[model samples]
Target: MWSGEESSRLYALRRFVDVYPTITKPDRHVRFNEKMWTTTFVLIIYFAMTNVMLFGLSGQALDLFSGFRSIMAGASGTIMHLGIGPIVTGSIIMQLFAGAKI
Candidate 1:
């Protein structure tokens, strides 16, 4: 009873899944100190990236999502323009797959 569009969508999703890489276990267990140091380093890098300005762009663009800045944990017009978008998108995809029992 599924429509043609639904079937086509399923086919596309199947093709994507076929090409997706399998998750591999980490080579070794991470110690607490190592994890903390890594976290600190990443945070420092993220903060530095957010502070870096975007070049070669006209200043005419407006940040409509300025209100959501606090929520996004990102500043506009920088490398963090779409702050945490990749992380959030990845989380959403993982949740969707988990919901689908994939």
Candidate 2:
């Protein structure tokens, strides 16, 4: 059992998190064409990024996590190589720490 009060140690962080900028939810319904266009644009950008290799990376550079590439949805030696992994990892770590009250 715990009270809802913020811990003194985390009071500053809580305030900072609250004031952080974030994308606001749309107020009105989005049109189908708008949604399709947005999806198509994003897909095109993603494909383009996947094809663009990292600058100065050797052609023979070995990928240690080649087996997990499909699962991670990332390209080897590209800018998006660690896409979503760090974000998801941080989220999970925060969740675990919060659950343990650490």
Candidate 3:
């Protein structure tokens, strides 16, 4: 358990996180069909984006992250080439700061 002082120190961090723009949670339970539909729609969009090659780029363009493509879930020459990178980086920095109390 955190002492009062520690909790107070973290309060500001918590508030900052709360105000950050993010997807809001539903107030009520979501039905299975609704969940399935949402998942399916998102998957369709992801697949479509993966197949979309960047226009005007050469077919033999060098792929800097070819080996890490699967881990990044990004298409090397597509719109999502930086997939989840910013988000993950932000999360990592936040975690490090919180851990180090900085």
Candidate 4:
């Protein structure tokens, strides 16, 4: 049905693919049990902290001075992102060593 209005669409096509005749608890917009919610919450907290730390009260302070400080601090963000690089690298290395790929 959506031909050229894809760019103007609100939600993605995949979400609209499965439709329920009636709205109930399971058919609600929000899925509370999913890991996406948890990841989104964590991202929000991380960005909030970064904003507060980087820009005290004035959002305009996100300029050269504050930017320099943030860069110098080597912001690996929270522990999860910090460890993710190493973990992914190690897993990839292990997989290659195990001859799992060409």
TM-scores for every candidate against the unseen true structure: 0.48, 0.52, 0.53, 0.23
Give one digit per residue, the lDDT tens place, for model 4 in 46-79: 6654434332334343344445446544333333
Which residue pairs overlap in candidate 2's backbone?
none
True lDDT of residue 94, candidate 2: 100
| Cα lDDT, model 1, residue 50 | 74
Which residue pairs show backbone clashes in model 1? Answer: none
Give the lDDT of residue 58 in candidate 4.
48
Q: Give the TM-score of candidate 3.
A: 0.53
**lDDT (CA) for every model shown?**
0.80, 0.81, 0.82, 0.55
Candidate 4 lDDT: 0.55
lDDT value, candidate 1, whole model:
0.80
TM match of model 2 to true structure: 0.52
Model 1 alpha-carbon drift over 4 Å, by segment = 1-27, 58-61, 82-102
Error of 3 at 75 (Å): 3.6
* Candidate 3 global lDDT: 0.82
Instruction: Put down candidate 3 lDDT per residue, 1-102, tens digits, no spaces.
Output: 767866676666886896789997999999999999999999988887777887887758898888887885767787677577878999999999999999
For model 3, the run of ten residues with the poorest summed lDDT? 3-12
Model 2 Cα lDDT, one tens digit per residue, 1-102: 455565356665776887789999899999999999999999988887777887899858988878777875768887667577878999999999999999
Best by TM-score: 3
Question: Which residue pairs come into collision in candidate 4?
Answer: none
